[model samples]
Target: MDTTSDRSRQWQWPQWILRAAAIYNLVWGTWVILFPHHLFDWTGVARLNHPGIWQAVGMIVGVYGIGYWIASSNVLRHWPIVLVGFLGKIFGPIGFLGAALRGELPWSWGATILTNDLIWWLPFAAILYGVFKIHSDPASRIPSVTRGSLEQAADAILPRPQSSNGKSIDSLSRDQPILLVFIRHAGCTFCRETLAVLATRLNEIRGLGLEPVVVHMSSLEEGERLLLSHGLHDTTHISDPGCVLYRHYQLERGTVSQLFGPAVWWKGFQAAILRGHGVGRLSGDGFQLGGAAIVDQGRTVQVFPAANATTSLPIASELRTTLQCAAPIPKAL
Candidate 1:
């Protein structure tokens, strides 16, 4: 795991690369604009009938240079700029090849292509890869820890995972075993599906004597707002932003197959598109998996790790873990 500072450092290379690219493009554009036929003469090609057309192309490249300069500040945030530029770089060479083969352009012009387009391919691809990694895998935002440290932290938190209301899981579950429901990033479609299920089956869960305590990796206010939106105002909420409880419960970071497998995609489509449990923006660690457990006296009596991001815990009646729970919270105002 990495921290915010580390992630910030990881993005530095892309920023610098983009900045250099911006300067290079601006200088190249200006050079082409000022002496449109200079490169044609160097490349041993006759001047165009209207050199203004080439200057117009130079103008367009200059505009792209401005976009790259803007994008350099936040490479990940301005992925579209990189994406378009990358495409242009790829296609520009192809166009050059076609012209060179048809005798409209000299092979010597490929020298310009190498500098203008070929040189940027790797760094541009790396920037795009960084963007994809940062978005899909948020583990970089989490603090680093060893297995021993994680075990110690989890040991301390699992029995006493602090709640928004200042009560500990151990204290709250002393009598009525709390159904500790762990969910992934708040934006996940399965998270929405699970919350909707809990909200719809709140009465059913309480009827079975399990006071559902939803543990999430978000702020107290954010957890409350998301839960309240799902009509789960009465359910208890635990804000575990560090995922100590998650590590304690053995819900490790999901694998690629578990998180983005074909099955998960289909299920996500079903929940988001068909069921209308729309996804939201990322709230916390996107890599963490979700699970459920019945905690009695802060000790896990029954555990149910989710099979994948798409398959959530059957929280209400289907939980094989028979909970010896009672006394649900009073209705929210």
Candidate 2:
């Protein structure tokens, strides 16, 4: 199970929040380091016995800012950093309360806690909660990949929903080879690119004696609309919002770099901006990853997990070569 994927989803807050937290920490740390007395002066609290300790605390807070900055790159992978920061934010106030009660710290010191720690609690907490929720949900769980024969894997995707007025996946692949195309989302720029390529090469694919079926984590209506827009209305599709088959086939989620790196951004620019295919409303889990497979006679001949969100599907020529290579040789007379 790719826990990172689960982290990426359902927490759609902009990256700027993390960036802002980082900047705030750095500035605040610098201020405290240079003028620890300002806080004491404003709160009317006597200075600490060792003012250097306050400076040391500022240094620690600034280090946390660096952690937050790194986490901004990919919060899911670097979640422990955020967890530590959140804990500090929580404990800072509790420690303050104990000090005030003991007359060791001024009540006004809570104002510093408000600015330095309390404000960040909810957003950080929200991210952690989202992480917990995704892992706990049985429906979205990612099943481990079985290191067994293709026939065993095929069994996992069984009882698959029949395509609109078409045969079940098992039935369709029983007599002929089928290319299973797992799509990321209908609104993805790369997915649009995939649609355009398939629409242009459908005839060539047919000539190679391969049937392509699309699996998406969106409603049937949304899938139909997207395919129709791309002139692929006739493409066979299966809607699996629960991602049951996805997990069964071991299609784990993508990581931060895989989904939103520079390469992905460049490809997206070409697809949506330069190519004039505008982005659409998100129709499925934006973080749900995708891949491809060749299923024949209840057996998987090839599996191609997408390298990233922007990965291109293997073109028809590539699939043809793979099929030719995997085909059984003629038996001796």
Candidate 3:
């Protein structure tokens, strides 16, 4: 792929747009972190029993501000970050509307939504549109002169990445079959649900002779923190900020219907609000889809690619049923 640096010079407004967003997020997050209950008081909502939980949410937003600041240098190359932020901005208000209708929250709460989410919609959308046009243009597309196949993927063009705990996938699964679970950015509620689900089913998964190896697109440090909260920080995880492994496995970027469809909205609400897997800001590639595979000896046995953002992560029984027809597993651990 050609370097986006030269192409990035073609655009100017996106840089400023992203920088402004970064500054706004940083200041807003700082304020919320320092006074977690201030926003609620201003909005006429009762104080929370757990202000620390709200403070943590502010921390997540503050982290996103850092990501936005890094991305401002090359908006075109960092379009995924922008996309995630845009989606969050779009959906944040909708979530607010749902609360207002249920009478659990007051309309006064919208003031923060205006600054934190609504105001950024158009500029963010414009930046995304500009990205779309660039990607749509033939000249802007990276030449396919190089081979980016799976064979080469296992042997990376750059050095292959290791799991968060300093182990390699080949080393971990060299002897036995492992469940390769590729998840979305750490911020996605579905991603959190996937991790939480896997945490509960760890023993059951090993019972099926498959150890879990998670793949994500967040920095190793952020991945560590996210997984630690779910008690899976010790689980094998690979940090692929560039998503090279994702493309190698043929996981493509999702479309509008795949990501933001009506069904997705309903499932998101249920998973986020009802299921208690609350969402977060963009911590990685927002457009990238996720999947799972059973691998032993460098090849996939059965692939379970997610059809959409909210597709349920397969459970232990589901894996057992699916692996029934596949190769026999060794009983010994």
Candidate 4:
């Protein structure tokens, strides 16, 4: 019979396998990056219509290779990078399925997506899950706080402190509803557009007796600049660089990359064409996108969970409607 220690030792094999997979990713990614055109030619795919395109592809593949190499070293912080890679793999196949359904791509494309995306998808997920499990466990604590709990704690730990601006969360009217819009860091175009929209409709939200709190991961100065750039100086702005609020509110989830490896370029092209822009690039390469959650009275009442990178959350109107009928907002004061 195997002893407990022996079983524990047996469990170590998965980590070794994960390391091997990481090495494989690094090698394959490097080949693709260094010989992109040659790889495409050998695969019978046309050289990208533009020379710069191939260069960009090479650079991206090279970076991905570096990421895999880092992840293989068993660095705890790099797990998110590994998760993004897994998402890329998964999204690639799903895109193929969509293409096949629309009769836009051949069955071979679907096959390619399957082999590239689904292959090792499960194992990668298991690896991530195992890592998170260990990290969450007190013995192996990774210093993570759960989303639901964190949000509640934020309400208590970081009470709306009064500042020069008299518009703190504490000062807001108790009878009115509040919209806490969490914006991404400066690099996110979607967040910028979303902020613009909010700015345009700031009065409309105010007309509905709703206060809008613009939350972002930046310095107070940066947050103020973002608001000013968007013509939203009057909006309440807060900065939380540690993503403590994001994690506490459970809005920090992002898709993995293995799900996206196959179809990313194509989707980028589609987006570019749709927007009438010659250059098409998927935002953040189908990973590293944030999520949204709505809460009231310290309870999560609504969550617009993302199925994948391509899926869009409901717009402001829809989100508002959903929140309207949600459980009553808590009166923390």
Candidate lDDT scores, in order, read 0.78, 0.75, 0.78, 0.55
Per TM-score, the best of the predicted structures is 1
Tell me the tens digit of each residue's lDDT in model 4 across 1-333.
212233234356445655666565556556655666765565555676765665665466456657766665553455787788788887777776897788765565555455445776877787776666444322222112322454454554433322225554444434355566665455455556557677777777666555667666656776787789879877777665545545545553443442254464455445445543233122221223444554444445555544433333346686668666766433322
Give the TM-score ranking, best first.
1, 2, 3, 4
State the lDDT of candidate 1 residue by residue for 1-333, as single tens digits: 334344545568887888888888888889889999999888777899999999988888888889998887766567899999999999999999999899988788888899999999999997886677565543333344433465454454333345877887777788686788899989998998999888877777777777889999888899999898899877889988777777667787776788889999999999999999998998887878898877766667777788889767664555533553333332210
For every candidate in turn, the CA RMSD to the true structure comes to 8.4, 11.7, 14.5, 12.9
- What would the per-residue lDDT of candidate 2 be over residues 15-130, giving only the tens digit for each residue? 56677889999998999899988888898878888999999988988888898888877676677888898998999899989999999988877878898889888888877755
Worst 10 residues of 2 by lDDT: 138-147
Better of 1 and 4 by TM-score: 1
Candidate 2 deviant stretches above 4 angstroms: 1-138, 141-162, 327-333
Q: Flag regions of model 3 displaced more than 4 Å.
A: 1-160, 327-333
How close is every model to the real structure, measured as TM-score?
A: 0.59, 0.58, 0.56, 0.47
